[model samples]
Every structure is written in structure tokens, then in C-alpha cells.
Target: MNAAVLRQIDPGMPAHPNELDRKRIERALGSRQRYRYVSPKVSCVTGGYHIESPCCSRNIDADGGVIDVALLHHDAASATWQVFRKDHRTGAWELHGVHQRLGSVTDVLNADPERVFWQ
Candidate 1:
């Protein structure tokens, strides 16, 4: 988590679009959200999944959509993370702006932050 990015955002807005697409991305990183919904187009495009990830992390989206976090074997020891917002053709929530999420560096170090998967 960098102070520079946080300073630019309101800290009351969710992360910007296509930053990383990781789930738990909003919370783990720390962002703002009012209400979010998945559109039929987006759902169809993403195969009904509100979020998509090639492999980075797991959790959920601002819309309560299930976005999971995954870790790469090569970066298994890395502690850095990033989150991106999803766009909806359904105009669920206005993509008015963007923001950054800051993970607790202390927590990652103390807990040996492991990749979180959905139950």
C-alpha cells in the first residue's frame, strides 16, 4: 500500500477498473462502496461471473459478487497487492471514478499472508 495513491483518491470510492481484478480486492485493499450489481451483458461476457481472475487472489466484489484471490508460485513470497473495478453495461453502479486499496503491511508480515480461497 502506497500513501501517494491513497492521497489522490477519496478513500470512499472503490478501486478503479481493470487494475488487477482480484477478489477480496476491495476489502483486503480497502476501498469504498455504496451498491453494485452485475449486468446481464457483463455476466454473459464473464460467463455469469461478476469478476474474472487468471490467478491472483480470492474474496468478493463490491456488489457481493464472488471474486476470489489467487497467488502465483513465483510470487508466493511477495506481499504486494492491487485491485481493479468491474464495469457493468447494465449501469448498475455508476463508474463515476476510481480509487486505491491499501492492505495492512503489518498484517501480511505478521500472518505470512496466504492466498485466500472461497469455501
Candidate 2:
């Protein structure tokens, strides 16, 4: 991972998504029935968040026991969100899609048209 891309949010600064956006993200993920049993965990980063879930696959050991579901970053200049799915083999994030709203990103994760995020 690039050092710039891994920047951590400053402790004194306000959270990247703020409370309202956080609530929206939580609600979006909550609405998915699949998440009810194995809820995804969300963590704040400098520009956005990382969504991860518990690993139960035979390859779980290789993934450190958790699977990275998605990465969402806000592009302030364009006011849009960039979505990324983990390339588990390489432990890198690959751009999946981009959307104008956070809800749209969650929708794509839920629909998983290409079987990217869920896998």
C-alpha cells in the first residue's frame, strides 16, 4: 500500500464521514439481510472507511482471519465516493466502481453484480 493511501486520521481532527455520514453508512449496511448473521465491521481511515467481515473460509489463515469486503473513499474535489474490493492474494485494493452517494456504493456491494465484493 502507498504511504499516502494509508494515511491515518489525525486524532484531534473530526471524523472523515462525520456522524451523519456514519449513520447513513451503518443504515445502508444494516438493511442487507445477509449482514444480519455476519455483520461487516467498519473502521475510519483518513479519507474514508474500510469494511471487513469475519473469515470462515479454508483460506482464512492466509487472510489473517478476516476478509476485507470493501473500501470507500470520499473524493472531496469531485464530491463522489470511490469503491474498491480487496485483491486478497496480493492484499491490495482494486477499484471496483465509483458512485455519487454512499448508499449507491452499498447497493453495489449488496447486488454484487460481478461477485466482487462478497467474494
Candidate topping lDDT: 2
lDDT of 2: 0.73
lDDT per residue as tens, model 2, 1-119: 43233335444443365655655676688766343566777887778988888764435354546688888999877878999999878988999888998878888877775657665
Regions of candidate 2 where Cα sits further than 4 Å from its true position? 1-15, 33-36, 57-64
Q: After superposition, how far is residue 83 of candidate 2 from its true place, in Å?
A: 0.3
Question: Which candidate ranks first by TM-score, i.e. highest?
Answer: 2
Error of 2 at 111 (Å): 1.3
TM-score to true structure, per model: 0.18, 0.74
Question: Which residue ranges in model 1 land beyond 4 Å of their true spot?
Answer: 1-78, 90-119
Q: Kindly list the per-residue Cα lDDT of model 1 for residues 2-106, writing each as its tens digit.
A: 433763676643332223332333334232121122211111112111323322121244445444222211111242232223333332322211212224421
- Indicate the TM-score of model 1: 0.18
